[model samples]
Target chain A: MNFPTKVYINEVVLRDGLQLEKKLINVEEKEHLFKRLKSAGVQSFEFGSFVHPVRVPQMANSGELYSKIQQAAGDADLIALVPNLKGAERAAQLSVKNINYVFSVSETHNLQNVQKTTLESLEELHEISDLCIENKISLDVSLATSFGCPFEGEIPTDRIVSIVHQVTELNINTLTLADTTGMANPKRVFQLISLVRSEFPKQKLGLHFHNTRDMGLSNILAGMNAGVSHFDTALGGLGGCPFAPGATGNVCTEDVVHMLHSMDIQTNVDLKELLKASHLLEEIVGHQTPSYLLKAGPYDKKYPVPVST
Target chain B: MNFPTKVYINEVVLRDGLQLEKKLINVEEKEHLFKRLKSAGVQSFEFGSFVHPVRVPQMANSGELYSKIQQAAGDADLIALVPNLKGAERAAQLSVKNINYVFSVSETHNLQNVQKTTLESLEELHEISDLCIENKISLDVSLATSFGCPFEGEIPTDRIVSIVHQVTELNINTLTLADTTGMANPKRVFQLISLVRSEFPKQKLGLHFHNTRDMGLSNILAGMNAGVSHFDTALGGLGGCPFAPGATGNVCTEDVVHMLHSMDIQTNVDLKELLKASHLLEEIVGHQTPSYLLKAGPYDKKYPVPVST
Candidate 1:
């Protein structure tokens, strides 16, 4: 709990959020969200990813989006999600602050998601790390479906640790244990996080969870106990997986930041500003969101100070 | 994970659903939902709580409902929530299969919720345990707000454990780490359940989480990873705490059972039947529910047999 006191917020509205929307947001809207998120105090952002435009038309102008996001970040770090070394190379070439290398732990998910076995992906991660280093860009590793996989259920924590060990050889400074499919519970979360922290005390650990099954915030709190200070979130509880069955939304940014702030914890974000950013995202998406706190507001008790008649 | 072949399901729709409804649900409608849920293969149930009828008038027929539920549960384990020793004794006299004795872990919550300190409530639990033993009825202990308290932000895990230890003196066979106020995260949940299990391995650990801030199912998954098997859920995601600030519905039974069964993990329950039960409950409540799987049927990849061109 004390460790997560200084949470590093990674805004994923551009990449994870936009990727799920039916209407493709042009480069301008992507730039608008990133700038607004930055002004609202998001420390890091995943601007449009470097995937092929033909494959995902929503990200056709990723290169251009990255350039704009770098400017919008304004000294704050901006990271782009990269599927492979090729994406990493493109991201590294940009002025954007960092690159997050994404891979899946479950081989079934790895093959289906990124079209590579986890082992092959790990090897590629090493190569990607080399490329990021060569280009003088920072890199963080994200293990998708580390908790459970849509195709392969109940992923072993040992399997996740092995991947971490492999990534450690590449000397990546940080790793994220992502509940990519929303299959994590507190028990597995605590065990995995504690295992990772105990094994690699120096490596920074982050959490990426979805509220698909509605355990995103709880999992974050569990990560807090394990001393994790970094997390991934989307505004207005937007974002879901088209491939993963039963997936809902990513843990809402305003919800997580709201819960943390209320606990007297510092997330270095403005609550009202974050809410505004969420509302704007909701407007852009042409949909209402799943954030209850944004609609209801915080619970506060007050009194007309006992009449001293 | 191996031990999770079959998960215990406790249907809280009657008690939790009715407790939160603004309009009064007559006894006949309550019985209808109860019969439908039991018909859907729910092995256990919380028909209604033994709280004062004046406070929760919807629960006035708890005693009458207990007798009716007994006929329905048959071999199924039936239970009820009790706020104090009086409620426990009344539940015991009714000879319901089990009684869940609850007390908040936070002092402020204990007083605000029950007009007594946590210690006083614990003493009442001791008396209830004695009553259960004397009546040859089964009893479970619920440490409310074990994760975090609304009035007191963080209730230390050690304090939660201490309450578990005190309740164990009465030899209560089961303990539910309740996120009464939706303040628990997976990390805290994992650590707490792990501690309780390691301390009292034989004790049946249950988790009762709230989706108030939207992390209920993930918390359950976390709990499962930490060696928990029993859970309390409401049909159609009904129920929220009046005292517990920001508390929402319990983890939806249909959603959790759906995920576990789809993964080939056994819960010995039928998914379609549960959905039907959800529909029945929705009819009685006169509103739609929050359960996604209910609104949209279980995830399926099957497409209609190819038609001749």
Candidate 2:
């Protein structure tokens, strides 16, 4: 039942979130969001992906967005998603400090998502790792579909551990085990996180989750109890699985921060300012985002007295 | 990390769910809902409340609805909510097997909600307990706002323990600690349930949670890990506090069941049949309810492969 007092939340709204959104936010709007998130005390931002514009047109302005936001980001860490060596090279050219490379453990998902087999993706990751090292950038590899696969059923722990072994061998000490389709439960989350923690005692791990099945926050709690402190969250709970239709967005950053602060856990992100950012995102998205804090205020907010009998 | 192999979910849609809804469902409609829920393998149901019709017009026809559905209930345990001696007497007339009485541990919430101070409610509960014992009806007392109060802030653990002590002294060992405003986090849920379990070793404890803050399922997971086997859930995630504005509904029965089955935990409930019931409830409610399963199909349901480059 142990939980970390302080947690590091990396905002992924620009990359993992808006990547699958219907509306395409321009570079100017992206600059606005980056600023808002920074003002909300987000020290880490995954601003964009270096994937092909034709594949994910929403992130086509990654190069321009990086140039515009990096100066404004100041001391905050700005990371970019890189699928392979080419993406890594593009990100390094922007002088990004952190480059994230993701590959699914599920073979079928790896093929369907990045058009590469699991081993082939690993090979590309090795090359991407070298590229990041040469550019003096830290490479963070995320094992997508590490919990369960949409095409395949439950993934074995051995498969996940083996992949982690390979990734760590490439000197990528920071890893994210993603619930790509939100098929993870509390038990599985605790089990997987504990397993990874024991195997790689010194490795820094983050849990990336989706609220597709409404177990996002529950899984996060499990991860926290298992002593994993880094969580990947989205503002206003934006983002959907390009593979799993009807799957909701990532876990809401404001909601998660509000919950953490309520339990006396320090997240460093200001809840009120985060809500303001969520409100702006809601307006920009032109629809209601799945933020519990935005809809229902903090637990301490008072309601009118009940009409008694 | 231990989860019960078998969990008991007491469906409260008819009683808690429909009570705060805007539309008034007819007796015949209630009969349909009860049958649908029974077919979903719900072993227990809180179908009606014996409160004064003037106060809660939604449950005015509890007597008629009980009479109509009691015969058809068969093996399922049928329960009704009773606010006072008169409500308990009315419920006894219908030969109800289980009668639940709820009073908030928070003095302010109890007074604001039921128009009675905590001591006054306990006094009434003693009389109601005597009536239930004489009528051979099982008495289950739920301590509402056991975690936090809408009017007041967090309730002290000692206050909840004192209330539980009062209820158990009446020989009503079945107790429900309800999160009236969905303010209970995982840590608080584990701590409170653990405290209560240690104090009342032989008592049967149930958790009633709301999705207001999106921690409903997380709280349930925490309760389960703390060795609680009984939970109160609503169909279509219906049910909100009549006292607390902007408070969302209870945890969706289908979503909870779906998550349990995903983790290989058995609840003996048919997931498909439950979704069917949820769909029917949605049609009856004439709007989209807060059910995740109804919107996003179960975890095992797969999506078409993404057309990747």
Candidate 3:
């Protein structure tokens, strides 16, 4: 499974995984966990979000979390998700390494989840893009609900392309398509991702998928074939969409790392230690997470062959 | 996400999936389920394994099931999975359309599970290939545990090549690599599949995967990048290996089809009907199943967007 180049495994555990849980992980535990995950080979971490404190209390300490990550590892790249211009402003004030500003392209979803129309969100995107450029922070524009939407099923490809066109025009080359609901099918994933790729040929495309429909990894595969190299995953498949209430967790981090490493796509993540993180997260979330690798351990460690020493 | 090409979905509910359970599905229920699954847009079905009935009583009525499938449809392409010479002999004798012969290239797994060395399995595979050819039956060689083996942690690409080299010398041309333990990572899948494509060139390549390590769909994506078209799956992710007690179920057919269809990869499957088949399989098995789409419903069908009376 040796593929010459390495694919980045950006840990979204601190943000995506923690956002939905009721219990807040304080700054110290966040730092300790992030440091441990880094030791297991995660290069970049989407540590938290600067979304409104009223909506996401769990991320109330993200401002503090960002500062600590810088203290812990000077070279570590940190990303904080921002939903609007104000959120982006909060992220920028912290002087973070990376700011990921998300907006939905699907009108129905955009109106419902973010309380803004698609066009309005696009306006916000322009403002955020300019602010990030002026501040010299790496900005990743995430098109949320890029696949199918639970609110609006079967999002059109043209809609996605035009959004990419809008964002790409701002000279923002890095982008992500979030499968907010487990709504993406491989064909839709391939078609939409390809459209994004063809339009932004030089852009780095990343995927943030949910396993709601159990095709998270497959969707990633579809995106990868369409020339995507980056992906977003949460540890232990944590994070329920507060909007969708019952939707499952984000695609599991250790699970993603395990698959990538096995495929010989160098994730540099030690599966044994990632499993250790799953163990740690289980305690924080106060229940077992949905990740199977967390429960079963790595493929090689299973049943331990009966060889005598 | 639209790619305008028909993707084949082969149902393996009876073979790989049923082989894992404690209770055997009655012959009537299995036939009834297959009949409905056929109508649900599954064009191909790996009817059952032709192994010893004693080893898998769950498959004690495979001969009956095959005859029923033939009687049920005039042109349904029913393929049967055959593990060795005897399984092949029984499958060849049956009035089925195709015979699938499997050989794991991993020496440790081949030894642990089948008590045969890799060389010996290849010898048996050669004989099975000849038997299918002489009988004028179409054949598919499944390289089981291809991604990684349970007993042997990582399967090398060279070993896969050696097996392919030996099998290609025989009368068989169609091939599949099975992630039998869900141990395969996308990178490994891409590299091995790419290697096989470069080497085999003209032969058809298929993938049969499990979500054990939660990377099955991603592996399929990797396969697509390397030009694989065919896939093997069980309805409802229902199988597990009884011989190896803790193994997981096969990749769910409806889930795979839904993903493809959503991606605009044309799978003939009707999501609602397939979910019905999954529900029916649950009734026959006298228990619930692990399929997400079956319980959660399709992304399009869910939240049904109301109706004007």
Candidate 4:
């Protein structure tokens, strides 16, 4: 029953959340969402990713969106997702304060996502790490498919540990283990996180989970039990992996915040304000997002007593 | 991280799942679903409730449906929910082998649901217990709103503990603590289940949770951690409380089984067969269900890797 009193939430609606979205949101719309989330006490965000425009047209305007919202971030950590050294250079050119260098631990996924092998991606991470150092920008590394690979079933824990070992060697601010295809169960999350925690006790760790299997919240609980506090969540549970089509995206932000707040674990996020942003997200997406809080409201909401016959 | 190696799922879709639906499936259709679930290794079921036919018309054919499917059950526990002594009497006349008597821990909710006080409902449980003994039928008790109430925000732990104390005195086979409004978080679930387990060391206990707040699976996990192995789940996550409209109902049977299986906890239920039944349920209900497995498939399902450019 023991848990951390405070948990940090890294909002990723604008980046990972919108990357697979069909409607390409303009920079102004992305800024509006950013301001709304910032006001709702989201102190960290992944606003957009610096990927090739033609490949991921949805994130093509990362630079424009960053420029428009950078001043309003105000002490908050605004991170951009960078696939490699070129994306890192693009983010640095825009003076982005923080960037998350993500690569898959699964070689097949890595090749499919960025046309690079795991070793090649690690080499690119080195280059991206050096670029961040030169630009005085904070860098975080996310190992996608850390839990399991779609093409290759169960990933060996040693592989993730080795990747973490290599990734932590650089001057990275945080290391995130991403369940890229939502294949992680709670037990696996607990076992992997416990191993990683013991292996790299001093490393600042975060977890990114997808709700495709409806194990998202449970996996997050397991992550918390294993001593990780930071989680990446999307507003209204938007975005799906291009590889895992028809599956859900990240663990939802408002749902996670509501659960944490209910358990007295402070996330410093306002549920009402977050719901407002979630509703706005639904409107922007032109479809309903798979957010439980948006559909059922909060747990404390009381219904009117029915008049007895 | 410790959990039970074996978990028992009590499928309640026939009773709780279809109760809230506008469509009243015929007895034959219900029998088809019942047989399908039975073939999928589901040995326990809450087939239907015995309420005023006009009041809950959805379960009006409980007796006929029970008769149609009872012979095929073949040692499987086919249980019916009874609201009071009259419902118990009706079930006994049908020669029902097992009956579950349910009353809310929250007096206001009890009054609204059954036009009786909590104390009055306990009085009826005594009568139902006597009838069950006379009919040679096993009896179980479910305390609805044991977690939290929609009318009353939080039901005191002492109130629930006292209710459990009074109910366990009868010859009840098992006692279930129900989150009628889906208000139980994992921490609260762990704390309450721990208290109940300590107080009634020999009592066989169960948990009934709703996915309304999306904490159903996590609460079940916490309950398992506290030594309760039996759980009530519905196929396709059907059924909503009449009192709490717009809120989702019981946790999906497939989702819970999927998670438990992923953790290597044996449920003896075939997930693929259960999914086939879930798809049939979707067709029966004439709409898509809120089942994660139906939407996302299982974690081991692999997609064809895109041919790299």
Best by DockQ: 4
Query: TM-score, each model?
Result: 0.72, 0.97, 0.85, 0.99
> Please, what are the lDDT tens digits per residue for candidate 1 over residues A190-302?
66888899998888888998876555776786677778878889888877655555566788898888777765678889988888888888878888988866764543321
DockQ leaderboard ranking: 4, 2, 3, 1
Candidates in descending lDDT order:
4, 2, 3, 1
Candidate 4: residue B306 lDDT (0-100): 73
DockQ of candidate 2, scored on C-alphas against the true complex (2 decimals): 0.70
Across B32-146, the per-residue lDDT of candidate 1 in tens digits comes to 8777777778888878888888778878888887776677678887788899988987887787769888778988777767778888998787778778888988898888878
lDDT of 2 by residue, B74-181 (tens): 989988998777888888887888999988898888876677899999999989888988989999998888878877778888878888887878788479999988
Please tell me which model should have the higher DockQ, number 1 or number 2. Answer: 2
lDDT of 3 by residue, A1-309 (tens): 123357777788898888888777788888888888877777888898887788888889999887777876657678888888898888888887688888887787676667889999899888888898899988888887787677677678788888888887886746888888777776667677777677778877888888888888777766666777788888898875666534677888887777666555777778888888778878767888988887666777645555524
Q: Residue A106, candidate 3: how far off, in angstroms?
A: 2.5
True lDDT of residue A186, candidate 4: 92
Interface RMSD of 3: 3.2
lDDT of 4 by residue, B145-192 (tens): 898888788899999999999999997898999998788899999999
Per-model clash counts, in order, read 9, 0, 11, 0
- Candidate 3 has an fnat equal to 0.64
